[model samples]
Target chain A: DAGITQSPRHKVTETGTPVTLRCHQTENHRYMYWYRQDPGHGLRLIHYSYGVKDTDKGEVSDGYSVSRSKTEDFLLTLESATSSQTSVYFCATSITSYNEQFFGPGTRLTVL
Target chain B: AQTVTQSQPEMSVQEAETVTLSCTYDTSESDYYLFWYKQPPSRQMILVIRQEAYKQQNATENRFSVNFQKAAKSFSLKISDSQLGDAAMYFCAYVNFGNEKLTFGTGTRLTIIP
Candidate 1:
């Protein structure tokens, strides 16, 4: 569990609405990442934060924005939810070099 | 950009048998690292094994091991005496030197038949 928790384990929202997924970690790790998992595509990096207010876009950054205002909290927002954005979101924390990544249980989002 | 490839979309092995999941990556860095992660139906990503690009010896963790070929840019995971617990989607990952981000493969769904 690594003291990581994700809010709204499952969500059902209508299209064109705004949605935000929260990831909170007690480990106070320096690195936090947001990834989306799809059936054939596997896991695609959405965004990541190296530190507070320091973040970078990943391979599939479109329609996704992230914020790391605090060391333990990282937020992912989908400005306008769409059906295409429906996927299982996972938050992972690591110390260094991706040797071991602690992932939250995961959040399944559905856009109706 | 580094890319990890898991060519086997699906594989199956009988109980107590051995199975190998193939994974290949493209990276120019000399000091990168490779990893194998397993995601069961529970959806929790668990680390299975890891290999350092600088080390020549294969990494073994319990019944899980990795065959790492640095020159061929290939790192494969082998499971001996496969058990039903080994049934899951296995992902191969790569991390470049000095970078903490990991790139993952599409994953190979491994099934352990009774």
Candidate 2:
């Protein structure tokens, strides 16, 4: 749990629509990460935030964007949702970049 | 780039027996960290154990332990006296000492027979 929460445990939306997922943490960690879990792929990193207003792309950041306005909150957005983007999204945070991460319950998103 | 691989997609063990899950990774860096994470049906990811690349001794926590073969580039998890609650999808992850990203394996679903 690690004092982390993800909003909209489940979501469904049509293709071409925009979707945003929120991740909130109370630990005040300096590092936050967004990942998507698929059946065979396990989990893949979409984006990550080190500090407020500082972010970077991951292996699969083509259609995803992220923002961290505060130490406790990080948001992931999909400009235009697609079927390929449908998967369980997880938010993780850690005290340092190299430490073990704590994950949220996850948000299941579906794009039809 | 670092890549983690979990060869056993599924495994089963008797309630009171022991079982091992295999994991291997390809990393060019000499310093890194290896981790085992358990995701139950509830979808909660739990940290089972961790092994630092520089540590020669295997890490142990309760009934769970890791056999870290640095030279072989293999990390395996051993669960002793498995319980029914141990049924879950276990993932092997690796992160370099100074890297910010973690690479995960496909995962192995472990089942404990009652």
Of candidate 2 chain B, the 10-residue stretch with the lowest lDDT total is B94-103
lDDT of 1 by residue, A71-106 (tens): 999999999999999999999998764557889989
In model 2, state the lDDT of residue B95: 95
Worst 10 residues of 1 chain B by lDDT: B93-102
| For model 1 chain A, the run of ten residues with the poorest summed lDDT | A93-102
What is the Å distance of residue B75 in model 1 from its true position? 0.4
| Model 2 misplaced regions, further than 4 Å | none
lDDT of 2 by residue, B1-114 (tens): 899999999999999999999999999999999999999999999999988899999999999999999999999999999999999999999999889999999999999999
As for candidate 1, its clashing pairs are: none
Give the TM-score of candidate 2 (chain A).
Answer: 0.98
- TM match of model 1 to true structure: 0.98
Candidate 2 pairs with clashing backbones:
none
Task: In angstroms, give how far residue B102 of model 1 lies from its true place.
Answer: 1.0
Interface RMSD values, listed in order for every candidate: 1.2, 0.7
